[model samples]
Target: MKKKLLVFTGSPRPDSNSAILAREAARAAREAGASVEVINLSRLRLNPCRACDRCRDRGPGQCVQKDDMKKIYPRLKEAGAIILAHPVYWFTINAQTKLFLDRWYAFGGDEYQCFKNKKIGLILTYADQDVFTSGAVNALRAYQDIFNYLGAEISEMVYTTAAGPGRIKKNKPVLKEAYTLGKKLVS
Candidate 1:
């Protein structure tokens, strides 16, 4: 059976570089015979976690909020691999992305094992003229730290720089890298 992969783009703007990178990877994964789905956070109405500890005390890994997140939980459970795609925003993920990550606490804390053994990848884009100062790697590492605690193995991390409002469209090499990474994931 083909692997089920979920790609979540943390960029608030649809079709932004972060999402473009994810599309490349998802396209490659599909070409390689993996079933893929990409969730654009910009369009989702996900509320921030209230930290009431209700999921731990009253429910089975369910959040109290009634929103688009209810549709996402099942997808997370069904995915064999999960990809978090985002642009480097002030050395970290977007505010909504940070909120989404924080909301994962509803999974009965870090030891819930829902994400254990899952493969993950990171795709980041940035506009820093200097590659070293772009902070993409640092931002990616921040994501890894959370996934690490959840026992999710990061299969790969892809970065693209000098991407600002369609600038990445001129960089075919990086796009190819994204596509190749996706293809390799399922091959």
Candidate 2:
């Protein structure tokens, strides 16, 4: 069976550098024979977890709020791999991405073990020249730590610095790296 990849674009901008990179990766994944779905979180109305302890007690299939997140839960469980594409927001993922990650609590403890076996990728674009900068590396490392805690494999991490709007398009190496990462997901 072909692997399924779910990409979450955490940029609020419609055609921003983050989304562009994610689009390129999705295209590459499709070309490499993996089914891909890129979700624009900006357009979705996702709510933050209420810290109600509802998921922990009620468990497994229940989240108290009935919002757009209902649509994402199934996809989360179904995806063989997941990619998070976001611009460096103060050296980390945007608030929107963090919100979604927190809601993963809805998937339950042991029942959500499906996520443990999945592969995860991180694609981060920043507006400053920070290749040697610790900020971007720290952000990626935090994500890697989370995935590691969840038992997910860190498939790859692609980072581009000083990228804004159309600037990423001019960087062939970064784009190729995204494409290569996508191709790796299928292998």
Q: What RMSD does each model have against the real structure?
A: 1.8, 1.6
Instruction: Provide the lowest-lDDT 10-residue window in model 2.
Output: 130-139
Query: Against the true structure, whose TM-score is highest?
Result: 2
Tens-digit lDDT track for model 1 on 71-97? 888788778888888777787677767
lDDT of 2 by residue, 1-187 (tens): 9899999999887558877778888899999889899998878998899978777777664688898898898888889999999877876778888888988878754656868779887888887786446377767878877887778898988988745577888888889888888878767
Local distance difference test, each candidate: 0.79, 0.82
Q: Tell me the lDDT of model 1 at 154.
A: 80
Which sections of candidate 2 miss by over 4 Å? Answer: 132-134
Weakest 10 consecutive residues of candidate 1 by summed lDDT: 103-112
Predicted structure 1, TM vs. truth? 0.91
C-alpha RMSD of candidate 2: 1.6
